[model samples]
Target: MTASSTTTPALAKEVALLAVLATLWGASYTFIRIGVETIPPITFIAARTLIAGGLLVAIIKMRGLSLPKDPAIWKRFFIQACINSVIPFTLIAWAEQTVNAGLATILNSTTPIFAFLLTVLITRHEAVTMRKLLGTIAGVIGISLIIGMEAFQGVGKELVAQLAIVAATISYAAAAIFGRGFKGLDPMMPAAGSMICGAVILIPVSLVVDQPWTIAPSADSLLALLGLSVFSTALAFVIYFRLIHTLGSVSTTSQAYLRVPIGVGIGVIFLGETLASTALTGLVFVVIGVAAMTFPSRKKTVPV
Candidate 1:
């Protein structure tokens, strides 16, 4: 079999996985909206991560996969948990209190732009190409357009809430680049470990801040929390790691673009939200700019 022919099916499978990832992640905003309606944000986030972490750890033990035992590695694992699970998760949940879920997801798509800029400025690992720089600029413009200048004009708390959502996007981007530190560990181990650490960290914070013992939740809210823990937090990370393994970071991150359309559809169908013409144009730009940023630019050279 020729190399190109052999590789085509692998590429096709990765694309399919990304599509599924996009759908799952897109629906997550809807689930978060449902969840936050009844449950306090900090408590809800902490509980979901805890449950998801416990589930993954159980699975790992059942499968007999060896997890790292070094205290140093464990520290990094804890940091990874904070970056990947704790901070951004909390930020997005709180931001969703005021911001629409769809718009929030669209802003979250700027994560790769942050990842790229961070890679260039912080690590000095990857050089900034003109295409990537242009893509980042366009993405910022697109996000600004989506939120609209008018929304910014006459606002008080709502404007700050929107800014918080944008800040969450920055956290996500930092997390993406920061997670590159986990290159040597088994992928599933890091996924499971960080979740476990996040649970540990969030438990104390959630107890003190949210005081779940006092806050009552409806049955529907409980179910939403279960879905968030099981599907969005646990299963989502597994699929994310699998995609990264198969397609690398660049391709896996491109799935962010798909979240916008998916979130928009969910918003209209479930939340009864109206879409503006301006939002549509901004969505198109975000989709295009993210695609431009993530599409593979490197071509394999043939050796004689």
Candidate 2:
């Protein structure tokens, strides 16, 4: 087969996988909102990580893949778990108590912005370019539009919740950079190991703070929790790794751009949520900014 013909089908498949991954992650916000209505944030996150971690373990065993036994590697997994899963999941759940799912997804899409800033400032992995600088400014403006002047007027709990979600996105960015240490390992191992570590950290906190044993969650909440773990966490990770391998990191990360609209659609149809005109406009700018940040730039070739 010609190179063009072969590349076309592969690209199409990757695009399809990207859409599916985006939908799965986008629906996660809606599920978390449903779950947090009855479940405490700590307990909900604990259950999510444990369930998802268990599913990954099963997959690993079924595939006859063995996880690394090095203590240093496990430690890295612990750090990654705290940053990527435990912190972010708990924050998002808490935030959703006051913030709507759609808006939360919009803010969470700022992960790439945080990632870029972290790379340039802390890691020095990439240099700041004009396109990236403009993208970062656009993201800031978009966030301001979404939050609006009204959010600052009252110093309300809602404003704090929104900030917490932003903090979570920053943690996610840090995790992305930190995760590079596991470049040689099987992707499933890091995913499964980190989730397992997250469960360990969260379970005790949930018991102490939430006393989850004392609370009887509703059927809907339980189902939502199940969906969050099985579909969003477990299945999504599988698809994510496949995309990273097949489409490369830049193409895979572009899934963040698709997630906002899918999340907004799910929130509106199922949760009866609505976005303000400004927030909708903000969403557009945020998507464009993130696209600029993550979409790989083409190298200009000078005539030899």
Task: Point out where model 2 deviates above 4 Å.
Answer: 299-304
| Number of the predicted model whose lDDT against the real structure is largest | 2
Residue pairs that clash (backbone atoms under 3 angstroms), model 2: none
Query: Which 10-residue window of candidate 1 scores lowest in summed lDDT?
Result: 149-158
TM-score of 2: 0.96
Instruction: Specify the highest-TM-score model's number.
Output: 2
Once model 2 is optimally superposed onto the true structure by TM-score, how far is the C-alpha of residue 73 displaced, in angstroms? 0.7
TM-score of each: 0.92, 0.96
> For all the candidates, what are their Cα RMSDs to the real structure?
2.0, 1.9
| Candidate 1: C-alpha lDDT | 0.81
- Candidate 1 residue 175 C-alpha distance from true site, Å: 1.5
For 1-304, candidate 1 gives per-residue lDDT tens digits of 8988999998998888788888888887777878888888889888988899888888778878878899988898898878777888888888777777787777777778778777788887877788888888888788778776647587666666667777877777787776777888777888888888998998899899888899888887788789878887778788888888889877788788877788778877988777567767777878877887888888898886
How well does candidate 2 score on lDDT at residue 252? 89
